[model samples]
Target: MHRLYVEEITETDGLIRLSGQNAHYLTNVLRQREGDNVLLFDSSGQVFDATITDAGAKEVVLKLTLQYRPKEEQSVAIVLCQGLIKGTKMDYVVEKATECGVSEIIPFYSTRCQFTETRKLARWNKIAIEASRQSQRVTVPVIKAPVSFSDLLSMIKNQTDSRSYIFYEKGGTSLKSQVLPDDIKTIYTIVGSEGGFSPQEISEAEATGVTALYLGSRVLRSETASLASVLLLQFMFGDMVYS
Candidate 1:
């Protein structure tokens, strides 16, 4: 069965209208007809069992038969702060990070960043939405606009009750070796762009109480580091382990 994301699904047992691209997707792309059944989800953490009551060129109507909230969401408060890596690579990182249950994704520009101009967030949000839907998560990770290295540091200084971890390519303590502070509610993981963080930048990050975490011996690409760190953190401190 096809799964669709709708903006607003208000009623548990009433007609819900899907217009514009959604309607085109159903009538033209999926070729769904009346009597077809599909799953519908909304940003409100609600899922609906819907049947196609009517299909037309402009819109489609679904009669929602059942509506229920999903299971409790992943409890981790990991925020992935990545250095801008340009184009599609950044998109891939956002998708993977969302699937891994990151609460937010921040792509910042550092000294070695390929480009500094912030990209529009429409595409990234779509990727997160699809990723969240596929991963069976009710909420999508918040994709933040790109910020400068200094700006990010300032943001770090302002964050109260949160621990910041900057993944340095140079020697630093491994992520697994550090224990999460019991008092903090959020964890920020910062990974560099293609050229990686410069020495002075790393020093400044550490001077401001950010822990420099090194991931083993091999030098991973920027995208790889961002995605891998999220999974590792999720497993160690997040909701990956059911037991």
Candidate 2:
């Protein structure tokens, strides 16, 4: 079944109106018609089975049939504290990170960051939503506005019951050496931009209690590093479990 993301869904059984972009997507883009069934999900982590009751040029109405709430599992929240990279690279990070089960993305501007002026929160959010839909995720990752490096440090320092790590190409503890804490509620992984992190920035982050991690001897692009860090952390701490 095709899955569509709605901002919120309150009624468990009723006719729901979908207009604007969503309506156009179902009617024109997907060529869905009346009586077609679609899966609808919202940020509340609820999935609904809906059948198209009315299909019009301006709007499409869906009748909620059933609600399915997945079994809750023990998972750590992953937050990517990414250094602002230039152009489409940042967009790729947001898209892939959401698919990789990242809970939140915080783009920060460090000393080595190239692009610090423009904030693409809207574009990133759109990418996140599409990625979530494609990945069959019930909830979309929150893409926060870019913040300064110092501000990012402060935010990490203030977060309780969370473990933070900064991936530095220079040198740091390997992922295998660190032990995953069972009580950790959130995991914050920091990756630098094309220029990478400066020594001073690494020191500042370390002083703020962020562990420095190295992704082996291979040099990776800014976008590659961002995805790698998220995926690795997800496997160890988040929802990427081996069955």
Candidate 3:
């Protein structure tokens, strides 16, 4: 069954009206017709089975029924603090990070970042939503607006019950040496841009209780590092465990 993201699916036992882009996506893009069954998910982490009742040009109505709700909430939340990279590379990071089960993404501006004034939160959120729909994630990751590198560090410093790690190519402790606390609630994985992080930036981050991590000897691109770090964290602490 096809899945679509609806911001809010209020009436679970009745008809729900979808207009504008939602309607266009179903009726036009997906060629959905009346009687077609579709799955709808909301930000509340609820999935509903929706049957298309009417597939009009501008409006599509769905008959909704409660389908699934997560049995338990995720204990560990993974957040990606990605340095702003070039155009499409940043988009790729957002898309793949969402698929990797990141709970939130914060784009930050650093000294070595090429695009300082880039603001693509809306586009990134769209990509996240689409990725969530494809990945069968009931909840979409929150993509925050770009912030200064200092602000990012401050945010990590102020967070409670969280462990932040900055992946630096220069040198840092290996992941194996660092024993992650089982009770840690949030994991912040910071990845630098194409130019990577400066020595001063890494020092500031370290002062804020952010541990410097090394992803082996090989250097990776900004996007690759972001995805790799998040996936590794997810497998260790988040929801990517073996069945």
Candidate 4:
């Protein structure tokens, strides 16, 4: 069954109002009719089986039938602080980041970023939402607007309690060497734009607790690094052990 995220869901009432593009999806694209089953999530960490009761221009009504175990969320809350990139590259980052189990994605502007602030942020959020639904993730990773390099540094300074790591080509240590306690609940990973972070910016980040670590010897694109970090982190601490 297809998955959909709704803002509000009621267990007792057993109904959900699907709106926006999703309505268009069910009505036209999927050609779903009354009694067709689909999965619904409220972003509250639960999955409910629902069937369409009605479909209309603005919204679709779903009747909840069964509720299953809450979808498995990442045990480690990793935030991907990615530098703004051009066009669909950011979209690819958002989609892959969610699938690999990132808790949130922060789109911040760096010195060498190509796109303007308004353009990239707008598109990144939509990509995140769609990816979360497609992956059956209970929570959609929050995609924050693009902030400046200086502003990011200040925010990092304020986040003294959280563990932060930056993927840098010149890094001396491997990201795998960062010892995350079994009980560690959250982590923050930063990946730079195509040109990578400036030396001054890297130093500033270090001052605010963002330790630089190399993914490998070779330089990778921002999207590739973002996905690689998330997957590696998950394998280190998450269910990737089964594989």
Better of 1 and 4 by TM-score: 1
- Please report, as a residue range, the 10-residue window in candidate 3 with the lowest summed lDDT: 65-74
Better of 1 and 3 by lDDT: 3
lDDT on C-alpha atoms for all candidate structures: 0.85, 0.88, 0.89, 0.79
Model 3 over residues 1-243: C-alpha lDDT tens digits?
999998988774588999999999998889999999999988888788989989998889899865776534368889999999987998999899998888999999899987777667888999999999998888999988889999999988999889999999989998768777777899999999899999999999999999999988899989999988988887777777687
Per-model TM-score on C-alpha atoms: 0.91, 0.95, 0.95, 0.89
Cα RMSD to the true fold for all candidates? 2.0, 1.5, 1.5, 2.2
Name the candidate, 1 or 4, with the larger lDDT value.
1
As for candidate 3, its clashing pairs are: none
lDDT of 4 by residue, 128-229 (tens): 778888876788888787788788778866764467788888874776677877666678888888889888888888887778888777889888888887
What's the C-alpha lDDT at position 182 in model 1? 71
What lDDT would candidate 3 get against the real structure? 0.89
Tens digit of per-residue lDDT, candidate 1, span 20-66:
99999888988899999988887777888899999988979899887
Q: State the lDDT of candidate 2 residue by residue for 52-158, as single tens digits.
A: 99999998999999989753533788898888888898889999988888989998888888768675788899999999999888789988888999999998899
lDDT of 3 at 176: 69
> Which segments of candidate 2 are over 4 A away from where they belong?
71-74
Model 1 residue 243 CA deviation in Å: 7.9
